[model samples]
Target chain A: MKNGIWVSKNGRVSEASGLQPRDALLFAPHGMTSEDLLQEQRSALQQNIKLIRTRLAEATRR
Target chain B: MAKARVFISSVNEDGLKPLRRSVFRVLEGLGHEPLMWEENLGPWPSYQNPVEKCLEAVEQSDLYLLFIGTRGGTFDAAAGVTVTHSEFIRAVDKGKTVLVWADAETKAIFFSGIAWKLDEYIAHTVQESGSYPAPMQALDFLRSCQEAPPHIDPYVWLLLHDIRQRGIYVEDLARGVETDWRGYFSDLLRRGLLLLPLEPTIAENSNRLEEAETSFDLLAALLPQVTLEPPHDWKVWLNTIRERLQGRTIEHRYGRWNRETVGSYEACNAASLYRRDGDSMRFISCCGRASAVRSFALNDQSSYIALTYAMGPRAEQVYYTESGQKFFYCVRSGPFVATFHFPAGSSWDQLRYIRYKDSVVSAIIGPNTRLVKLVRLLLGGMRA
Candidate 1:
């Protein structure tokens, strides 16, 4: 989730990412909107899913 | 999108009605199940406690998505907190991923310290009242309880303060006005896999969905997956057992061992039973009723009847046993003792199913259901 813009296929305004209140959350640094932190989360998910996919591919090949 | 059972928690308030409805629609659209607080719960018998039903849902969910509105929910006399908060605490205690969402505008105002001014006004309007039944440790909502003037939403401020002060992160507390909640939640569901507690299936599902190039492909992959119904009775809550095992806290839950109660109890066939110790009862009692004798055990120190016994474990006790080459990772509900048998060569989740002396897969190492494995796999190993 660290770096990338995401556009939804179903189309709601993806341009302005959703920001939860900064003071209200943790792991959220100053000067970054909550969406930026959420982006890191999304990015991590993509990577993990890729890891699992790679593993699955290996398993199937075996 | 990853499938998940989200236990949607909220007080019944007009402000939140639309959010609940829309969230349900969004969850369904994303191929996830939304366990609504009301309506979607319960197939319980009349005598069963409603709290058990809600707790049951909380137990079954992959995520505890909580919505704290501008008011307190219905207070449960037995539990002492609002039903919603009790469930919230249970989710926290249970180690579930709790995404606490409050009214963003109200949270901002509370953070701004307008709550002090609001309380000052409320200080004048305060009427004589008895204490609110709440644990000071969960929150010192005691001050809010005593001082709140009518008309102002005191609970949300008290709530924001309580949740924040207690170190519970309120980061996800965003809502409608500035954000498209649908997009927000859709992104949340699609990306929520990273936040799941720990399940073995996350890897399996990611692989299954990896080449799912189309929505049709995704549906084709998911179609054979089994949907697990909530346990009927006496089935060991594997999540609870795993957590308690880690925490080293002993606990027991008693249920009548009968035909209707065998939701996932592996010894449903009643294949074998252990001989009772002279000190232990041939019949057992467990922790539920007082001075009540029974065909089954339902109280503390109640003897455990396994395999061939007519009544199933009235109390759950955890232990690991040896069965030749493969270690039987068994959990008995009445007492606690164990050995580390997860030889490095074994995967904990795959080693979860155990074999009894009779060579049948018996009670609790974990359910041997294909549905359990499939759901866990598809769910991105949310909890193993």
Candidate 2:
């Protein structure tokens, strides 16, 4: 119901912000300074890798 | 490369006319989507500046193929550039693969110092004389001999400079403009042709001319696709998406798209999710051309609203806006883009809907879109 809530696959609720600024910047549309698109893409990918690691850790740990 | 949506841009209608069709045929034959303004959208809706639509295509395309020649397309005073010029800028900004085919003159202009000299000449004249030289005097000064580059739109050089700055490779059309323009405008009208017909070409230009009808003959090649009405099961379809979103209710604020630009479109009316009213652009051309018979007759191509919602980590929803209706989406799963529309009146809780309309959201869908769902796309009747 609020921002910053995401559900893990196994009926688990996690409270944290949604996509980070690094993630959001990846989708900035055209006509804005797109010269930064490549850099934003790299940042978004790196952030995604970190988030995936956290989620995987939570799922695998006993 | 995988099949891509290619945008062919040119300002010289007559000069590049045949080449446009050939490029269209070749791309279409290769199962790639090729978008051309006149063919894909009927002479841009008069209600909105048509060039705006072209820029949007540049934004959406995976590959942008540009034709640079003597003439520059119509200039938008508000934007301070020609339509073709703006398209190039957008393709560059969007970071798409831009393929430029430059005529000998255009190539020379870009690799040469003409554009810089011209800019400096004008600036220097203004600095010293307190005003620009008369148009003719300025043209005369641009080159040692005024025999060539006759009456060109100065913006052409600027566009070439932009190509250079972006480091995009320029494939020379090498087919230079004929140096026989003692009176070129009269010559085109007297012969009444834009350019000679061509075999399919991505790089093409010609000094020859033909009958005017020759250019439009391929207009028939771009015959409209079959328009479909909305399917009866849209509610069921949308329900499936809402479920797969894993009950993820996207907070409207998470998108990266600046809501400011979305609000800028003439049609966005207070940026309301519900347009204040349907546009006549849906029914007629703003320029009074034969709109009824053109591709816009289906009305789905140009007369809708687009919104993308990225709820969380790869979960995105692309919504379709119809006049005065509540927006609904066509959801994208890994390989499938499931098309669905939220029924117009059903989803609007006035206060919430109004809030959703006003708030800026991030862009969930980036530049790439799969082609499989283009048919059942938001183009189908009512909504997607």
Q: For every candidate, what is the interface RMSD in angstroms? A: 25.9, 22.9
Best prediction by TM-score: 1
Q: Per-residue lDDT of A1-62 in model 2, one digit per residue for the tens?
A: 24422222122224323332211111112222111333465466556555444434432345
Candidate 1 lands at a TM-score of 0.37
Off by over 4 Å in 1: A1-62, B42-45, B114-149, B171-182, B185-384
Q: In angstroms, how far off is B213's CA in candidate 2? A: 62
Across residues B253-325, which tens digit of lDDT does each residue of candidate 1 receive? 1111101111122211111112233433232221111122333332222222322122232212222222212
* Clash totals, every prediction: 28, 5
Considering only chain A, what is the TM-score of each predicted structure?
A: 0.46, 0.45
* Listed models, DockQ each: 0.03, 0.02
For model 2, fnat equals 0.00
